[model samples]
Target: MTFFAEIFEGLRISWAAIRANRMRSVLTTLGVIIGVLTVTMMATAINGLNSTFQTSISIMGADVVYVQRFGWFMDRNEWLRSRNRREITMEQVRGVERQLTTAQAISPVAMTRKDLVYQRRNGGAVQIIGTTEKQVETGGLNMSQGRFFAAAEVEGARPVCVIGDDVATRMFPNESPLGRRLQVGDRTLEVVGVVEKRGRFLGMFSLDEVVFLPVTFFFNAYEQRPDLRIDVKVGSLAGIEETREELIGIMRKLRKTPPGAPDDFAINQQEAFVQNFNKVGGTIAALGLFVTGLSLFVGGIGIMNIMFVSVSERTKEIGIRRAIGAKRRTILLQFLIESVLLCVMGGIIALLLSAPITLVVALFLPAALSPSIILIALGVSITTGVISGFVPAYRASQMSPVDALRTE
Candidate 1:
């Protein structure tokens, strides 16, 4: 018979065997199903989170640069050791302003977590950012009502504030917050503006849970040290590279870094932080995938074991076929097709199970299920079937008709 004829014959026989032992065949394919489901679901969720963060970061403006004593989201050791280090003061902002004319705007920010109260309503804890008017534009904050503080207002330590949407819902539910007075600790400040809903980033902190006041007011009300950080925006988006370098040089000069010494201050860009997050997340995902793959590998071995047993149980039937002039290669192909069919069946079933779960996840959480994941699952199952089917088919083909009959 031709190769095509042999494959047709093998597929028919394989189908018969699967139908004869339906439960056994299903149980055998379950391993591949579980493995494919786990990896695909995780990949979908990670992809969604990655997309969400990228969008959020893009809204913060591409040309913006954050200057601080430490880098953004550094290791615990780096943070703990840098505790006693000097803070980035407003002077650094002025120094960069003086040295670099490439930047369009620059301002420092000081932050604190405090309980806020207005009339009878109060929020548990809120982020209070003491920033200049430049932060209104540079930080991607949009005012929903009233105007931001002016440069003069910041310098004069004006008691003006801008609140976020979450605080708006909590502190001023009924009335418009504009022109109302909200108490930040012991001092009261006039609400100049309310920010529009900025949504959540990093899957944790809501951007709308913040309130902005002038840094001068923060200093007077809290008696805090000058531990503020600066954000700089370049004149042209294309000039960010040159602008970053110019800012770094100015900071180095202001900090008086000696010749050949590395910069004490750190400049962190949005892309850099996103890259770091992806690296760490990718590593964890890879590790989990590896562990899950091992389970599937063990399952593949079980499939091979079952196929071997089936070949042994049908030794007499095989001998009869060989006696009737069936070629050894034909016999081999039959068993190979049977094994592949088993895995393919499992792959189909697994995919069916995974689709709804993926859809549900995408609905509840920010995630995307890729078509590649389904293709990969199919490929892995087919490959597993072929590989595990080989040895049993080889053993069956080696059996002799006279001996196969004698055993019975």
Candidate 2:
């Protein structure tokens, strides 16, 4: 017979065997079903997390660097040292901007959390950012209506502000926000622009629940010295490392650090955040895979045990087939095909179970099972079947025709 014909015949025989004991077939495949379900769910969650983080980081601007007093994550000793260092100032921002040859834009940022009110409407505990006109460039902000505060307005510390999309929807639900006055703390400021909807940051905090004002205006309204950071946007992604080194050198010179002294300020970037997130993500993925892999391993052992039982039960049938001139290779192929078909069925059932689970998870996170994951699950199941069934199939193939038929 042709190769295709042999495969077809094996599949037909395998299906007949499975149908002959439906309950047993289903019970035998339970291990594979559980295994595939665990693996697919884990992969879906990890992929979702990766997608969410990449989106969040992109919004923060990959080419932008934050020059701040402290790094995002640091050791206790480093934190203490950073705390003692002098706060970044607007003057230093200007100095860096003046000296930077590869920077596209630089802006100083100061932030506070304040309750925003518009007549009777109130936006509670909104993040208030104080920055200059160049913030639009450095932060990659896009306006939905009107425009960012002009350079003159920033220089004058004008009582003008740009609101985020959530702020606009909340404060000016019935009317256009442009030209309307809003109360930021005790100060009344005109809303000159409304930012486009820029979803959550880190999938935890809403980026749109914010207000941006001129840096000078913020310093004026809040009598206390506001905490400051400088944001620098580089000309190209390729030169980010170079620009970072230059920034460090400039900061050291500006801060008057003694030669060989450790730097006080932190030059933070999205890449640094990504690297840290990846380390944590990788660990989570590894742990998840290890646990789920155990499930698959257990399933393989179950398949192996079931195949052995199948071989024992089919010894008479094997002997009969051998006596009828069925080749040993054909007998091996038949059992192996039966094992593989069982696993493939289990994989399909697992995918059906996983779909609803993944949908429920997506309601909370960005989870979704992709096509590649489906294909991988199927492939894993098939491979597991082949490995688990090989010994049992070989044993069945080696049966002697006379010994197998004597009992029957």
Candidate 3:
């Protein structure tokens, strides 16, 4: 009960001191405010990256594996070897469909960039994807308008197209896009469906700036012998490794290479993207935390320096308190409380500033001032106060009452 009373009195005295030296306290708190901002922002960015990556990967279909001629990332020698291999053909895709047991859906995909025109408005360098109705499933598309182009449409080599939401809004802002004709280079096609809006990938590249059309239409219009990638969607995530192994054997046999030589085709899975993202994102987060931690360190040092000055100026007060029978621990608690108050004040101000800053940051990057960040920032501020004020508080407590009184 005595200890609790002492702590209450300590808070009272400390708060009074801070209020009395309002200007000094405010200036001292600036460092802590800056430190809190950096830490909060860094944590927010790291969190945003994780969520954004998951969202983006889902749009690309996490369950689907890509079988392509070239790997997504490879060494120079690997690239050359892959370049020398025959392109994965529509025929091979059919073979994979026929033989593969693990795959639930298979989509033969090819892409090219073309400028799209709706009346006078031209969309610059829009990506065009050529795939079948299976693309609706394998690509994780949700139809916001109309429906996926039917299998009969693909079979009949219809020049119908499915537009992304962004394109739909941009091209036909005033009216429905369904049944409207859009020009894809020299070719004219009718929009049969509009895919739901998927924002950007990593808040950078737009995912909704693409058009999907039949594979035959793509081949006849773009490349005669198009380089194709087969998207193989699996049933179970737990069996992904087995799926990859099954794909490798099927590809090796399909390619008809001997058992000793390396397989010509690259079978890419979501795990590759996941593993690489984790490695890179972890390094970036570590570096970000380290850099932000320095600001806190500097703020702590500034608080320590100011606390020493505060203790020097209050030596006579300490002397009087000791003469009145104040314990050393009481003196220690008082200054420590004052330091913590200053830091907590800074943390509150920092949080206030973070609201607008977070809004602005969200415009360019996906960021949020989550509840966890708020708690962490305040906890850091309190901890910094304790660590910074300890040495100065100990010095003040160890002062001789007689010696302190003699200075005045």
Best by TM-score: 2
Model 1: lowest-lDDT 10 consecutive positions: 35-44
lDDT of 1 by residue, 254-340 (tens): 988887976787887776867887897888788867876786787688789889988988888788888888878878888889888
Question: After superposition, which runs of candidate 1 have C-alpha atoms over 4 Å from their true positions?
Answer: 1-16, 45-49, 52-56, 59-63, 73-83, 143-156, 173-176, 234-241, 313-337, 348-368, 393-408
Write the residue-wise lDDT of candidate 2 on 195-234 in tens digits. 9998888778889999999999998996447658999999
Superposed model 2: Cα runs more than 4 Å off? none
Clashes, model 2 = 0
What's model 2's lDDT at 107? Answer: 94
- Which is better, 1 or 2, measured by TM-score? 2
Of the pair 2 and 3, which is ahead by lDDT? 2
Candidate 2 at residue 61, lDDT?
86
Error of 1 at 143 (Å): 4.6
When sorted by TM-score, best at the front, the candidate numbers are 2, 3, 1
Query: Residue 270: error of model 2 in Å?
Result: 1.7
Q: Candidate 1 or 3, higher lDDT?
A: 3
Give the per-residue lDDT of model 3 (tens digit) for 272-377: 8889889999998889888878988888888999999999999999999999988999899888998888898888899899889999999889999999999989
